[model samples]
Target chain A: MTPEPSPSAPTAAPPVPSTRPAATLQRRLFLVGSLLVAGLALSVVAFGDLGEDLVYFWDPSQMAAAGEDAVGATIRLGGVVKAGTVQWQPDANSLKFIVTDGKVEVPVEATGAPPQMFREGIGVVVEGTLTKSGVFTSDRLMVKHSNEYKAPEGEMSAEERKTLYTTVEEL
Target chain B: MNEVAEPVATGVITGGWSYIWAAYGVTWAALLLFLGRALLLSRAPDPEPE
Candidate 1:
């Protein structure tokens, strides 16, 4: 039988229940731990493609802020070929053009066979670095295409930029 | 985060079967771990009697 309430217990205290479950707490902690571990694992694997150099694309505005540190920094610049400003040294495999973002212009020099779609008046993204000559040496080039779905036109050059830069649409 | 208008690459997994398989492997492992954690939580032991 339950012991009778003591006189000092006249102010009877109600029975109290435990607020937390030990196992539940442990498991919750384990789940959170697992989540954190999983996140860490994914980060390591994700960084596998990013080399130690940690290069990134930058606009002409950002180039100055990066300072001398910008040298040797691999970057990709996206812009259009300024009209009437393309100069290709055909014998040397180098094509120099003014790349603009409608804000500032950056000179780019690419030495190699350009992508099939490479042309003037079209959007392009260049991957490379800025040189001592203040020109970007591209490693890769891409030509942007319209989603309208149509066949591509051919190359652009000194003659084309001067004449064809005006007629945006195909004949 | 470069120009939002232009996509860097198409979303389609065109590299090859190897790249596709690797992505699926990571996805499945994460899903299984999440399910396992949920089951453990649902089966948490009840509080013992005082």
Candidate 2:
């Protein structure tokens, strides 16, 4: 037989179920969704600026073909340095050279000590703007080295170097 | 345009490796911090029963 309840005892109500789990899950989902949206927005803005600033690499022939459209825009030009066309002024710290990709040649003027490996007949990438006059004013120059590492051949003839600074400067 | 535009000479960018390194460092630090925070939260103790 069950014991009888005391007259003085107070009745206790049933405990309410907790909603903490659902609230915690909702908070997590909100945080994750917000982060995703924010990241997407940030990348869109970053890429937009990058697309404008990042210049395209082009060879001498391609740059020539680009014509007036190539002027005033920053571009990275890649070509082999034409032999016998390098003019360096030590006092002025100015260097001039003609970059040729066989078919076409472009004159480049840069102000800085050439890198250790810089020389004639080597591939190089010059980063700068092409003026309306057609001279590439390079601020940064990078020499490209081949894996084979063969020594440079003899000097090119004066006839081969005939198409030099004069031709490109006229552009 | 009839008039030829003058080229804007940009200065040579030298010694820029420091900035590149700093950017990489900050990115890694942020990633690590986020991972640590997530792990800490996942291991946090549940609330005591009322």
Candidate 3:
């Protein structure tokens, strides 16, 4: 019968080998470990010393409530300069003012000349340590100006005119 | 006009480019290391069954 079957019919082709690489347990562990280490390194670099280096900004009222904890610690006190409390001593090169939050007032003795914009009733930020005698001894002072701008509504007072025209030494 | 001109910023920020380059260097180093690791892992042969 002509050797029966012709042996030409092909059986099911062998399954094609997968081409994509499979992730091994070791590789997965390495990936996880690399990510964990990177995250830890970034976190340590960013947040280390955050607490110790942070300088707290407090108003007079908040500072007063802090009591002894605030004493001798470097802090930034922000408040409006109390009117009639500004005393500039040109000979002494010292500026003494009282910062008030409308409820509490803190006396500040700052070394060096004040900024041109610094005046009574203006917002200011003083940075330094609080003395045990309840006075803030500041080495740096900054004037804070409001974002709102409007044209002058009235004539300038003599005092204001003098400040605008006079130099620090003349003041 | 006698009006005072609007105040303009006269100061220039100096020496910040080094920090930017340093940040890019770190990022690129990490990326290249990761890429090398991935390529090496992909080309490695799987162990034959014992």
Candidate 4:
């Protein structure tokens, strides 16, 4: 049975439920969303400056398509060294060759010695400027080769051994 | 002897696994830490009104 209220007792209102947890969660979500947006903006700004200093690699056909805009700008031209176009002068220390992407051919003139793996029909990336005369003058030449490894079937022949160490002069 | 020798393997990249594992470990550790913080926050006791 319920007890009767005393005449001298003071009456009070019930307590209200707290909304602090939901408010805290909403504030945290807003903070995280703002940080994500700011991070994306910062990345966009950083990538905008990447084109100014980073060198671009282009194929011979792309170079031809770029036309006069490609001249005087330092770029890395990637293509295969055309066969029967390699001319190396040891006495003058000059190396000249033609790079082709099967559709377009670009003549390249490079100074100093090339890499050991540099040969005809091999992929190469030459870094330099293109002249008005349509010759790519390169100071840096890099050879591109596959990373595959295969076991020899048998002993290497004498001729194969000789060609392996041969320089461009003997090509 | 005229027997052919076995060819040695070359150019296989074997040195970077440690770096890859370390990166994954750090990422998982950070994710778990954030998850634990979220769980604790969800189960936290409400503040008493003054």
TM-score of each: 0.42, 0.45, 0.46, 0.49
**Model 1 Cα lDDT, one tens digit per residue, A31-88:** 9999999998999878776654554455666675566776677888777877656665
Q: If ranked by DockQ, best first, what sequence of candidates would result?
A: 2, 1, 4, 3
Per-prediction DockQ: 0.05, 0.07, 0.04, 0.04
Question: lDDT per residue, candidate 2, A1-171, as tens digits?
Answer: 644334333365333234478877898999999999999999988876876456567999989998998899888999998876777766777888899999999999998877766777888899998998889999899888779844335576565556775687789
Among the numbered candidates, top lDDT falls to 4
Clashing pairs in 1: none
Query: 1 or 4, which is superior by DockQ?
Result: 1
Q: Candidate 2 vs. truth: CA RMSD? A: 18.4
The sequence of per-residue lDDT tens digits that candidate 4 reaches over residues A54-140 is 646899999999999999999999999887678776677778889999999999999887876677788899999999999999999
Best by TM-score: 4
Docking class of 1: incorrect
Report the number of the highest-DockQ candidate: 2
In the predicted model 2, the residue pairs found to clash are none
lDDT of 1 at A7: 38
Global lDDT scores for all candidate models: 0.69, 0.79, 0.79, 0.81
Which digits, one per residue and each the tens of the lDDT, describe model 3 over residues A47-86?
8867545645788988999999999989999999886677
True contacts kept of 1: 0.00
